[model samples]
Target: MSATPAYRRGMADKDFDFLHGRWRLRTRKLRDVMDPTCTDWIEFDSVSEIVPAFGGAGNVELTSLATEPPQEALTVRLYDAGEDLWRVWYLSTRAPGYMGPADEGRFADGRGTFVCEEELGGRLGLVRHQWTRLDTGRPRWEQAFSFDGGESWETNYVTEHEPLGE
Candidate 1:
C-alpha cells in the first residue's frame, strides 16, 4: 500500500501540528479573575500531551495541573475545512459532567486566538485564549476574560510550554 502524500493535505488539516507532543508547562495565574487590580498571582506547574486525530483534522489534549488538590483538564480541537477555522471545547475534572463553551478561531502570523461566551464568577463574560510560539520554538498559552463585551480584557492565566526533554 502507498502512503498518503503530505502536500495533498488542506490548510485546515494541519493547523495544530505544532502542538503534537508532550509538554511541561509553567503557569502563572491571578488569584482573583474578576479583579483586574489583584496583584496576587500564583505559579504552578502542569503537564500536557497532544495527539492528532481524525486524520490530522483534529487533536486531543490532556493536561494536568499541579494545584493544591490537583486537577485535570481535557480539550478537543477540530478543524472545519469549509470555514477554514478551528473549533475548541474544554472540560475539567473540577466541574465534572459539564463541558465548557465552544471557542472558535484560526491561526495567523504564527499565533492562534479563540473566544467564547461563558459565565465567570456568576457573571456573563467573554473568554479568550491565545496561543503563540516563542522565540525558542516553545509554545505559550494565555487566558483572558472580558466582562463588558470585548472592549476590555483582564489576563487571568498564562502558561509557557517546554518540550518534556528540553
Candidate 2:
C-alpha cells in the first residue's frame, strides 16, 4: 500500500510508550471558502488516558477543546485501538465545524499519520494529520488538506506534545 514495513506493525507497542501523558496542542488556522488567509491560531490542553481491554491491546481517549460554539464545554476525543499500533478514530461531534469525519492511521518508527476523506456539496476533500518525534523529546503533530487526490496538500494545523508529569 504505502510502503510500510512489515516489522512496523509488530513493534507498535514498544514504540508507542512516548504517547502516554498530558499534551498541549497548537494549530495554525485554516482558510475556508469564506476567508483566504487564516491569520488566527488555536491552542488547547489535552490529556490521553490509556486503559487495557483484552488480548494485550488497549484504548486511548483524547479530550480537546472546541474554541467556538458550546464554548468552554465542547470537547472531542480521538479513539485508538492498540492492536493496530493505536490507529485512531475520531468519535465525537463537538469539534469545530471545519473538521471533517474521523481521520485514522498508525504509528511507526517514531512517526504517526492519519487521514480523513470527505465529499461535500459535490466536492471531494481530504484531511491528514501526522506526528513525528523530535530530539527535544516532543512529538510534533501537523495537519494538512487536499482537494485533488493525494497529489497536493496544504498545512492547516500544528501541535507539539509535551508529556505530562515532567
On lDDT, the leading prediction is 1
Model 1 TM-score? 0.89
60-157 per-residue lDDT for model 2 (tens digits) = 54555444542322223232333353444554444435444666666655567778787733667887778787445687878776887878877766
Predict model 2's lDDT versus the native: 0.55
**Candidate 1 lDDT by residue in tens digits, 1-166:** 2333454347657878888889998999998878868999999999999999998899999999998889999999998766667899999998999998889987877789999999888899999999987445588999999988999988999999888864
The alpha-carbon RMSD values of the candidates against the true structure, listed in the order shown, are 5.0, 5.2
Q: How accurate is candidate 1 locally (lDDT)?
A: 0.87
Model 1 worst lDDT run, 10 consecutive residues: 1-10
Q: Assess every candidate by TM-score.
A: 0.89, 0.63
TM-score of 2: 0.63
